[model samples]
Target: MIEVHQFACLSDNYGYLVHDRASGETVCIDTPDAEACLAAARARGWTITQVWNTHWHPDHAGGNLAVKAATGCTITAPAGDSARIEGIDRTVDGGDTVTIGALTAEVIAVGGHTLGHVAYHLPEAGIAFVGDALFALGCGRMFEGTPEQFWASLARLKALPPETRIHCAHEYTQSNARFAVHADPDNAALAAYAAEVTERRSIGLPTVPMPLDRELACNPFLRADDPALQARWGCGDAVATFAALRAAKDGFR
Candidate 1:
């Protein structure tokens, strides 16, 4: 069995340690800080054998060398931006697969926040490691790719099974839900989810790994094309609705 351990770092960034109990081997995903990753591995007595990066962002890939130096792990990243990413031993694109003991994760290109961002989907395990592509109740800001690209990427994620556990790279659910409320005040599901997230934050608990189906129902970004959301944003056009949702999220807090 594979168990996921989340390590909070760099304010809101998250690093994950996926462990395969059968082999006592672990894979660290998006090491925001190498020290934390090392400590977590040592604490669990699991050998870190691989490092998987979702993109070339410093916060995500900054600690690659340190982790590899400490653990002698192989580093893997998307091939599209390998030139920008330092210390990558293996470069893979969409449709490539990475193995962890008995399990395998398929690479899915879901760029939007960055030009070459990607996600790892393990269908048998019902889990997805999406860096900055899909968040709990929001999507990544459009830094390089266009709205069309973001839309296409999200649609690809939406095609996954409803029960897939979405592992995002940040803890932005509460803030995202605040914008969701502003985008659609009449949405009972959004209101209830926001309240729940607020409680979780108050207690220092994580509000992530949300089901994809729940995001489809409550995330304003995913509902950009919905008729009700378009009407609430004071526009019937699809692009206008998406813009309004992003604007609302930008000014939510």
Candidate 2:
């Protein structure tokens, strides 16, 4: 079995620890805070042996040095922007396979948030650690990539199996749900999910690790291809619909 532990860091960011029970191999996916990751590992009595980076963003890879110094863990990161990342012992790209004991994940080039952004997918485990490419009810802002590029990246992820549990890197679900409700007002799934998100956040619970299928039904960004929605939003096609939605969300409260 694969065990995962999630914790908060640097305000809204999240850090993750993955453990493969069969081989007792533990890995940390992106290091928002090395201290938080180390502490989480210590609490579980698990020793981290590897660190897998999804991108070169400072918030995600900033703790690489500290984590390596403390755990002596090997670091594998994206080769797309290796020049920007530090302490990467091994670099991989889209379609490359990485391992955690017996489990393997394919590195998906999900570049939109960053040129080197990647997503780790363990198909057998029915889970993925998508950095900033796809969010719960939203997608990442078009910072370093084009709207069309971001749309393409999102389309790849949206096609994944429905049951795939997405482990994104932030706690932006509440805000995303709000934007979703506004963008896709007639979507029953979005409305219900917004209510649920409101309740969960009211009590201080994390709203991550969401199922992909639910997001497909509720997330406005994912519905850009729907002909009805496209007409409603005054978009000519999926790409244009995506741009309109992203632009709207950028200025949304």
Candidate 3:
């Protein structure tokens, strides 16, 4: 079993500590703050062995050097962006598999927010560490890729098992829900999820590790193929629905 610990850092960014219970080896996904990750690992009596980066963003990969120096851990990053990411020892692409004790994680290339974005899926543990790709109720902003690429990336994630737990690297569910409601007003699932997310935030709880199927029902971006979204956006196509939803989200605030 892999134990996941969420580290709140750099305002709302999340750094996940994945520990293999059998081996007592810990691997951090997107280390936004190295000190916080170091403290978390030490407190749990787990030896840090690897640092996995989803993208080359400063907020996600900034602490790679610091953590490597402290733990002498190997840094694994996307092959496409290895040149940009510092201290990357092994660069993995889609179809690559990473192992931790008895668990194996598969690599997925889901570039949209960045040119080299990736996600790690641990089938044995039924968890996916998607950096800024698929969020609870929102998708990442298309910074370096086109809408077509972004939609394609999201489709890849949608193909995962419904029971797969999503672990995104941010606490944006509340805001995402609000925007989702605006984009898809008639969606009862969206409205219901928004209310639940509001309560969860009010209680200072992390709204993550959400089931993929639940997000598929409530998240407008994830439900681009739904009839409600298609009708509201005036299109039955996934790409058009995705564009309309993204535009709505951008102007939500």
Task: Give each model's whole-structure lDDT.
Answer: 0.87, 0.90, 0.89
Off by over 4 Å in 3: none
Can you give the TM-score per candidate against the true fold?
A: 0.95, 0.98, 0.97
| Cα misplacement distance, residue 120 of candidate 2 (Å) | 0.3
lDDT of 1 by residue, 98-146 (tens): 9898899999988778888889998989999999999999988877877
Worst 10 residues of 2 by lDDT: 181-190
Off by over 4 Å in 2: none
Off by over 4 Å in 1: 234-240
Residue-level error in angstroms, candidate 1, position 67: 0.5
Supply every candidate's count of residue pairs whose N, Cα or C atoms clash at under 3 angstroms: 0, 0, 0
- Distance from true location, Cα of 215 in model 1, Å: 0.6
Angstrom error at residue 248, model 3 = 2.4
For candidate 3, give the lDDT.
0.89
On a 0 to 100 scale, what is the lDDT of residue 14 in model 1? 88
Better of 2 and 3 by TM-score: 2
